[model samples]
Target: MNISRRQMLILLPAAAVAWKSVLAGTPESSPNYKMSEHWWSMLIDISKCIGCGNCVRACQTENDVPDGYFRTWVERYHVSDENMTNPEVISPDGGKEGFPEAKEDGGKYFYVPKLCNQCADSPCTQVCPVGATFVTPDGAVLVDQTYCLGCAYCVQACPYGCRYIHPQKKVVDKCTLCYHRITKGLTTACCEACPTGARQLADLKNPNDPIHAFLKTHSVQVLKPQMATGAKVFYNDLDGSVR
Candidate 1:
């Protein structure tokens, strides 16, 4: 009665689902929060970002993320006049303490913050063998660590290299968009910490939300658009050189 790895992977989801059903009474952090009434997303204004690293520090403190790994990070891109398509990107210590001064000053330098896109058609959610990764009703992607197999299938499926295996918990981990705070009617730690208002929490479902106005007037793009993951995070003033 032995099963190969491939067969076992196919079988694990059933067991995980059954186990989850038994413990289905997991209480919501904010019981009054209505998932149907909102859609969560983020807007990153590349022009406003100063590479201050406040967002990175705030995310780590609020989420208690591991020292070396990052749930949210900032990358500095140096695009030269000769190489408009190829940019030199760097993120030292996940840009937690800011970046060093650029040695070559001829090119345009800017900071791009990275995090979980919380895609509507996330590959991670579809590939989770244990049914641990899933999208919420309000357009957030989350992982049930208790049921996670730490198999890294979702990690491999992610096009943006956002997901990671936790060092101690042995579960796949990534940004939850500060789900706890958001459901409680608060903004994400990173967005709140950004001094220049570089990061903004957006709710597409809310007509009055400023994001609607911003989206109407500005040109925006998502990372790796070719993957067609239905990414929720939008970048404003994104340069063509960004990868």
Candidate 2:
């Protein structure tokens, strides 16, 4: 009850240091997360999508995406009978407000959700001038903001328009597939928010994963297969007009 002034000063400094560490969030959030032993992928079943935009909203809320930028987006396709190969693609405001009524109803309308494909041979990572972007062992391509030069090489190299320069951070940013949640054995925000079950997170390394069954049965294709990026996002019933 009777502490000297020197003792109080020392104890106060120690307490302040401990409080700062907690506020800084320096402790590893997930101690058990392993970079190996898992490869992440996403499955978008076109047949199941309803163009609700719930996925878009959830991703923004989870990732704190800036206005006019998107880590993931949904596009509505209008494929006419005569031109199935050249469907009209539109995503008004990244479909963040959901699609408007089809102005003209002459074609088959479907929704396609897009995100980083986690490509095994990702061009984005290849062209990063500072090696800021890299593919993790588990197949997720991630950016190291601290090392990034904001040179926009990765943005230009990406064929899918996935990477964007963060306005505030000045770093190239893209979808991490909710890596924080995945390593803790949870699905992505978009997947969780999808009301139609259109989006499914897949672990390719897991033998018991439903992705194996889906791939075996469904006619699926990755976007820009000609690029030969080994894209992990498989779309069921992907249209020819998608680019």
Candidate 3:
């Protein structure tokens, strides 16, 4: 059908406006997301941590993590110059409550928050016989609880003591870096609760992310570099005795 130029101009603008309205009212479909384009990481400022346990509690509350187990925790490290290799580490009750007063000792004390490294070459995933535990395209290591064999192989394979078999779920569980929240463009619960800004969720693939600037200016290190799991969590001013 042919239309007059005057009629075509009026209809074209109205149709374009309606199309934009429909798009604005609808959320983007997840199937269209290309998760492979993102690589995730976390940055820990050891100097800023105060062992407040806010992060620990937030993680448990957000994930419903089991008691006497931790997807994340904090440890107080006491290192004496006389024995740098044997730093005393303590995290009573997984540090869900803050620590008590200091004891009489001549040493330096600091807090170190621990969580999943979300390793690129994670041992936990390699040891899963059923492939129940796997990494997402966005770089989170997750377990399919329905498929997990309830074996502790993933726990054993983890060098950083980050994995555990859930007592009730009967499946391997660990930190997913709050994949549910991050995918929706929100930060992790732990990072959100960290009062001192000690924890930061980072997208290494994003050039504009502040983590890129932090890395360039700071001397950062990951736990047990020798294992070479391609651990992604980075710590700033990490003590030499840290394992």
Candidate 4:
């Protein structure tokens, strides 16, 4: 069969359009395409944590956490089911000093680290009238210091009490998950400094990521599920009563 030059010319543009359409339909080319199915979340194994405080110090030095405020903190919960009145909650003056010596009291106790919950439906982002707080492409919730008014509404709305107004910058600030470091292919200071490997940062987008596998193998819980913030932080072996 002989094809004329005119017929070949007529077919070229249609072929180009078809090719373009196929490319446009792909997930990578779509404007709203998200590479990961879920946002990053952290899981802390309280049983494995020894309260070394190395994580806290690393966060301070790495992120420049201010003297009076913390980007992350830790709390100790002492529980006595036998005596409801004797239940006590304790946190060291600062995560700076790490956890105190464990007491020999006749009760069960554990230490839990706290940081920005980084909720998918974050109240801080909702209440920010100026659009200063926003989620990044990688799903990290962050506050743009330049856009912040320092109104502290975000500080007030955070359920985990993670957000705080920077005393020197006079802007709202909190754990950024060490955004700068993460973007550089490095782990957060806290994660890197954790002596026992209790704190781990995992990418939820990749199914092969350890966090996705962990979430599948174990049951995890978020803080204040009743609030429906869709918190991304996860706790393994968490006590139901402890918030």
| Most TM-score-accurate candidate | 1
lDDT of 2 by residue, 1-243 (tens): 998999999999999999998977633456777777798999999999998889889999999999889999999988887887888889998899998887656778889999999999999999877788999999899998899999998899989999899999988888999987888677999999999889999999989999999999989999999999999999998877778
Residue-level lDDT of model 1, residues 41-67, one tens digit each, is 999999999999999999999998999
Stretches of model 3 off by over 4 angstroms after superposition: 1-33, 103-105
Local distance difference test scores for all models: 0.93, 0.90, 0.91, 0.80
TM-scores of all candidate predictions against the true structure: 0.87, 0.85, 0.86, 0.81
Question: Lowest summed-lDDT stretch of 10 residues in model 4?
Answer: 26-35
Candidate 3: C-alpha RMSD to true structure equals 5.4
Query: Which residue pairs does candidate 4 place in steric collision?
Result: 36-205
Candidate 2: give its CA RMSD in angstroms.
7.9
RMSD of 4: 10.4
Write the residue-wise lDDT of candidate 4 on 152-216 in tens digits: 99889998889988889999999998777666556788999998878888777767778877888
Total backbone clashes of candidate 1, pairs 3 or more residues apart or in separate chains: 0
Query: What's the best-to-worst order under TM-score?
Result: 1, 3, 2, 4
Q: Indicate whether candidate 1 or candidate 3 has the larger lDDT.
A: 1
